[model samples]
Target: MKIKIVENEQQLQDAYTVRCEVFVEEQGVPEELEIDDLENEAIHFAGYDDEKPVAASRMRLVDGYGKMERICILKDYRGKSYGKELLLFMEQVAKEKGIDKSKLNAQTQAEAFYQKLGYTTISGEFMDAGIPHITMTKNL
Candidate 1:
């Protein structure tokens, strides 16, 4: 297994492919919401198991803060701690980019996951893409 930040167009596409499969196809997120606003400017990462992508995520600078978004792991890869690894990598990336704080709007089901990473809830549960979500943040 190899986990590293994606630095090329091919890796970026692979990450987006994983997100599309999990978020758009499996989770029923709209294609429009799944693909919007992501571009070359966003920082992307991928986790490969035997050279095949099994998980991925991306972060973008928002108003001088790093916002982790589109975190997805293939269904077969869940419950194996890959998501935690990816989130840790994102935190390191945020620090490298000179940001000391990070934020994400996490799905309600994932609130506990982020909480375990030391993120605090900042808002009441709300709907995003028809699913429950909450704002979370942590200092790097």
Candidate 2:
């Protein structure tokens, strides 16, 4: 598997497709909510397995820190560590931009996944798009 910073329209669209499949079609998140106005402002990353886009994530600088968002991996790619790899790529990008901290709102069920990556829960569980979520952060 290979991951790279999305650098063109097609790559961006690939990232969107992954998110739509994971968040909208599979998880029941509204399509409108899944694609937000922040797309143009964020740095997107796409992961591929032998030329097939299978994972994606986005990051943006927010208040001197990096905010990682919309991390998704296609169902077929979930157990292969693509999600973790995409996340590490985002963190590397953030650090390159001088961001020493990163934050994300993780789905409740995935909290432990983030924890294993050194992120700590920073907020109480709350509803986001009708799903339980909590804020998490890690110092890069």
lDDT of 1 by residue, 1-140 (tens): 46778988888888889999999899899988888866667888898989899898889988767899988899999999999999998899899989999999999999999999999999999998888999999989
Clashes of each: 0, 0
Per TM-score, the best of the predicted structures is 2
Q: After superposition, how far is residue 122 of candidate 1 from its true place, in Å?
A: 0.2
Q: Candidate 2: TM-score?
A: 0.98
Q: What are the TM-scores, per candidate, against the unseen true structure?
A: 0.94, 0.98
Error of 1 at 71 (Å): 0.7
- Give the Å error, residue 73, model 2: 0.4
Query: What are the runs in model 2 whose C-alpha is more than 4 Å off?
Result: none
lDDT of 2: 0.92
List lDDT for all candidates, in order. Answer: 0.89, 0.92
- Per residue, candidate 2 scores C-alpha lDDT tens digits across 2-49 of 998999999999889999999999999999999999988999988889
